[model samples]
Target: MNKDLEKLACKDLIDLALLMPKKFDDLRLNDAPILNELNCTKVVIKSKKQLAGKRLTCIAYSYNWECECTITIFNARPFHNALFAINKELLIYGKLNDFAGLLQFVNPKIIKNSGEITANYMIKGVSDKSISEIKKKYLNYESLKAYDLLDEHIKLLLTMSENSSDAMLLLNSDELNECLKFVEIFHHIRRLNETYKNDTLYKKLKTHDINKWLKSLPFSPTNDQLKAILDIKSDLENAKHKIRITMGDVGCGKSLVIFAAALMTYPNKAILMAPTSVLAQQLYEEAKRLMPGFVKILHFSGAKTKFMQDELQDANFVIGTHALLWADISDASLVMIDEQQRFGAKQRMRLKELATTNDVNPHYIEFSATPIPRTTALINSDIYSYSFIKELPFKKEIETKLITIEQSKELFNHIRIENEKNHQAIIVYPLIEEGKTNTYKPLESVIPYYEKHFKNVYYTHGKDKEKDNVLSEFALKGDVLLSTTIIEVGISLPRLSIIVIVAPERYGLSTLHQLRGRVGRNGVKSYCYLLSKNEFSDRLIEFSKTLDGFKIAEIDLANRKSGDLIDGDYQHGASFKYFDETSDNIILQKAKEYIHKLQDK
Candidate 1:
């Protein structure tokens, strides 16, 4: 790679080919020059005269037009005087002007050749000549062929590299942009495959029958859940290691799938790491109730070290928070992470490393309730296998409303009625303390009012050390809970019937969806109120129309014009130069089809 090319962040042949020119200079000879426009013509210097202030004036005779034209060079140096000698044959290119009815060329440049167009680049610290040289070396048929690009794409890029009329024709065509978008996605998927192909399983996992266990369950599993289980079964039985992400909507029974995976890895051990201790305990309780009594299930958190060490040796399924990362364990064949996006990459990698031994990696699976758009999921399927569970175990009936401060009396009355029914309500504030720019009351300022009117009021924030305890206590005896967005994921509140978000317009649609999901967990009537000073918000209005998290994600993507609403790690900083996640769905589909064909071969 050239040092100058490296400065422009060109990493490969594809990158070099995609470095499009900002503009092109057409120096082709013009037979008929237009007045007050840039023209190129062959000319001969008939006479030259030096003026005051180092200016030179030359009378040039144009061969094509058969006319004499005036040429003026400002601040003319010694080279300029020498070049414009008497009767010198040359090609001049510049803007022709009519100064007082006289045809003139002001500061016209001498062109060595007048039949070819030239490309001009706009990169800082890199000259146009250097960029042209780099392109000539890398953006060729042979070089692009080595990267397995299609012939059509390579030819289009080659034409773009050359300075010609054909290059301009292709540059303005839609076919060229589509080709570039396709190649960008194709190259990204290939790189991701190569990066993930490094690890393999030492041996295929032994299959375990889940039919008997399914029959033992109290209710029938949804078809999506069954399919996800089968996908995991196939991955476990393969010699090649696979990493799969199973995304489900809120209260979509993902815990059942987690339990099923544990059942498949019965004799061998399986481990699940959750983000919060409250969620870990919830899954632990569900596992104990659902799984057979024969399986040894253990829950580890901030408890004593000796107790955890003793149970770690023989436990079939261990569920815990980040405390699981520090525990010593070996020979585990499966690792599952619930709410996988909550943990950093290093934290997830550390948990996976604890289970890896004998040069064999465990089958990794991530479970997330953060739903994404279907198009995005399809695009990312090239990198990782995905299973979506959009079907809820039970249809949720939640009334979402947009409210204002003028409706405070009605909002307070609704809260009181829900409280009178022995149901719980939660109010989420944007901040803990008031700031200069705050338009709504902070949690601290409003705590007094809630405490005076509502009995058994509990409050917590993300930075509170005892938030877990507070949440647990609130779930048991509290009538109202006040907190930040920390309750966005993981704690199952069956009795939570109402969730009022102060300044709801300040949050993303997906986040509002997740927060709304906290209610109506157990098929009870629930309500979500969006309290804002503004009477109307398009995003909030759209969010209140549906309870589908995936659709909410699409709306959010459309409003933000960014893919960062999805997992941040998968986006690679959302820095795609050509591929637009918002509007390039068709191009992505074509690229995926092509890559699939190659994989089949």
Candidate 2:
């Protein structure tokens, strides 16, 4: 029997029993059962040593009979962390073994004082006991009814549930209950492996009116756009009431797909929401131009007047900013969201509230250029149905290259020649607006750059109200656009050929795709220059070497996961911070499981 382990209390004894090999009989009191397991000594491997000629040569040493088998090896120095220097007693657990006739203990676990185990120490080693440690901290669960433990914010809003479905006001409880009921009902009614017969007007265009629209268009919808449209259409048709989420590359014509759907669902009210006023206005004008029947569009933004909000209520296909959320939407049936992930879960839940009433819930179609990490988890959990449009629209090849300051000079010379040949170019930097104590390049105040490089150069940033107007002019009449990433979406001009992004490594993959998207609208041979000055620029350069947007996206998503803002951007309203994907998922799963067990209790 291990003497050191005898000192452990009942709780620690149980922990040891749970962790040790089953071959070791359970510890019993007063001559109860068989007990052969010893408190084994922990030996840390100082360095990789070959077992040669009946001996293992190393600084490492193992105790013949020490309990609590925990040993830590430090990578910094040989023999480092192998043993306590001050002869501090440790409870070690391991089996003695002979390797090449030399004694060793291959695996060991430690039972030590809680205070001695720092957070950093616990994280460094991988052991079977990790599960127990994790269950102990970071999780405090109790039993309550599913309805009882609902977040307080949700509960407070639920009380006024009568107006829950009204987008203008936050949801009250009745509205939330109504939405929950509808979701439950829809979940029951949802069909599997279903596809809708293109009965909508958008489907009509595909068969009859599409050619006309296609013929009228100077540029065709990229194959990617068509696929996305079809995927969204299928989701709309298959679900009991369409509930589909679609993701695509930036400038992938997501709005066009929405417009086509709206056209097909005409005479039926469709309400589209954009996160920002600028995006909302852009969507509204584009939808109206495409559908063209006195569209009766009302835009509700923070900037809208009371009169605007009042009139917006009756619009058939009202589109606008969050202000649209304030408009009464009792009659609006079809709900669509652009940049859906930008809003928090609470905001999105509000949208769901607006789309439902006590009796009926509107079908929802969510659009995102950047797919939230939760999308996959949701799909895995059978929470949401999904479809993807992964293909690009055109075959015209665009060369994407990463350039440094020196490389950018040569690229600039080439761009200059292209500009002289009547083509336009865009040079993008990270900072859209000038700052007081700035570190990033000022894309807006680049007068010195303009004078040094080109005959005529224009700048546009997010802060500028004339951003769209300026970008349009630059694409049409100007020789060069020395600008920021604001032109990543929706703006189209065929003559604008080259996009040179400064400090490309600072931008997300989605942002880069959008920037590249700005010029490829016309299927012309476009060029994208990725510029950076950081160590990470090597990765950006490697990414630029590939023209495949999806491939770049995959790499970017992986790299972004390692950043501080990774979880901050997604999981809106989620109180928990994520340290790692696997850890977070396991924690959530365990929490949910605990809740379920409590309910069972």
lDDT of each: 0.82, 0.53
The alpha-carbon RMSD values of the candidates against the true structure, listed in the order shown, are 5.2, 15.1
Model 1, 1-601: lDDT tens digits are 7675577777677888888888777898887878977789999999999999999999889998998899999999999978999889999888999976777999988888888788877888888777887888767788898877889998898989888888866775799888888888787666656655535663478967888999889999999999999998988888885568898877888999999998998877899999887888889999999998888998987676557787888898999888888888666788999876567656777888888787778888888776444224433546567788988888889999888889988988888898898899999999999899888888989899999988899999988999989999999898999999999887878999999998988886767887898999988999999988977777788889988766776776656544332233542235467887768888878877887788788
Q: lDDT tens string, model 2, 1-601?
A: 2332332221122222222111221111112111233333334334433343333233344343322222323232433334434344444444444455444444334544321212211322443244334323322222112223334323332322111123223322354434333222222112211222112232111211344564455457767667766665554455353357777655556777777666544555678878656577678777667765645666666665576755765576777767656667766667788877556655665775675666455667788766554443343233455656555555545788766676766997888888877888888877866788765667656767776768777877777788767866776678888776666654656787788888776676656766776675667778888776655555576666765554664455455542212122454222112223323444345434544454477
Question: How many backbone clashes can be found in candidate 1?
Answer: 0
TM-score of model 2 relative to the true fold?
0.58
Judge candidate 2 at residue 102 and give its lDDT.
Answer: 48
Candidate with top TM-score is 1
